[model samples]
Target: MNRGLRIAVVLAGGLAALMLAGCGKHETAQATAVPAPAMKPAPPTPIEVKKEEVGGPTWDPEWDKIVELALPPAMLSGQVPHDVKRFCPAFYGMAEDDKRAFWAYFFQALAGAEAGLEPTVQAKHAQPEMAVKDEVTGRPGRTSGLLQLTYEDQKRYGCDFDWERDKQLKVGDPDRTILQPKNNLECGVKILDKQIIEKHKALLSASGYWSTLRPGTVSYRVFAKQMTNVPAACAVHNARKTVDGTR
Candidate 1:
């Protein structure tokens, strides 16, 4: 009877050891089968801000914020020395809200879309005059100053002050009203405003102006093409209607 009891006790101990070993194996298998969680991507860095000159209105912090959004790095890099007050007196007439809105439109949005607020003058006749007359009409190619404002545009735009004769200047002299940032901006705005008002079309919408210009492969078209989105800056002015009812 004592021998029988000893054998039974040994059998019980063996069974308990087997059960523990099986439990350990199950835990290891479960750990290996389970998957790890995925990591998330990092966010992009913000653009750095710097102090620079711009022509239009006095530097209001609020207007500066609008400029920051509208103007690109290239425009900011080309600083204009003239005070905003010198050129854009129209800003003074506007309500505070409207003034801020116009700055965004004229300076940030339209200026960016146009040939930029700075002038680009092309001198067609840098060479000595050969005195050749045109078959269609008598005209010489030699001209200078912004917009390549041939003698024709100069007369039309009333910029008769001779930058060429006075300074023997190339492109981008401050005396050239065309090169003046505020003047350039004002001229560009006036041109667009004239077109919109005369045509009596709702020019504020992206599709509206895009359709009117019907931009081909010209340089102006290319500039407009780059500015695909309608600037949020213009919304404050909210003068979308034309003299006529065609939207």
Candidate 2:
């Protein structure tokens, strides 16, 4: 071979080797490279709830004193006076301590407003027959008793039970009189229970009445008025811690 030809062949061979080395490096990089790991979805969050609150007056020990002072003289005369406690067992559950306190306070206020807890023997002018008479004479008046059921009241709550004729046969048993303490109280509580059930459509504890009847409302006033001497009676009863303490 000539010197020029040999030199050209040698340069071509060197160029070919360099190109093959570059190809090998590219293939090695592709094989060694790694893909990123697959991503995971995040977890879900939780929900929260809120509770409701109730409100009312705390039980007071001295509330009984108010009831005792408000009871009728007849109640203190060693006789069962006509008042709310005598009839409405529900009233005894007005507070957390005992329902009797509520009954006593209620009747105490009622007795103070009405005839002082003496056995209301004589049918007052507020009696149904008499009130109707008074109405015709242009003198409308409210009736008496722990419930204070008026003349018109007889038409509504007269005979849920005929305790007067059924329980006792006295011509005019003051205790059993429709407007007297025992009868009036029984009728009143029954009426209230019926009203609550009718309105709410459920059975209620004694405390339920106070909770349902908001203070300063007409219902509270009417209830308080009907249950006169209740505070005084409660005070007397609590002080004695005996049912017969008033007597």
lDDT of 2 at 179: 44
TM-score of 2: 0.30
Q: Model 2, 7-92: lDDT tens per residue?
A: 35544554575466557466777577543222111111010000011222111222233333333333222232223344343333
Tell me the deviation in Å of residue 152 in model 1: 3.5
Give the C-alpha miss distance for residue 231 in model 2, angstroms.
Answer: 7.8
**Over the stretch 121-237, how does candidate 1's per-residue lDDT look in tens digits?**
433443343234322224565333222333334444443344345346644556665555444443434444443444444333343322223334354454444333323332312
Candidate 2 residues lying further than 4 Å off, grouped into runs, are 1-97, 121-146, 150-155, 158-176, 195-197, 200-247
What is the alpha-carbon lDDT for the whole of candidate 2?
A: 0.38
Residue 104 lDDT, candidate 1, scale 0-100? 43
Best by lDDT: 2
What C-alpha lDDT, on a 0 to 100 scale, does residue 164 get in candidate 2? 29
**Local distance difference test scores for all models:** 0.35, 0.38
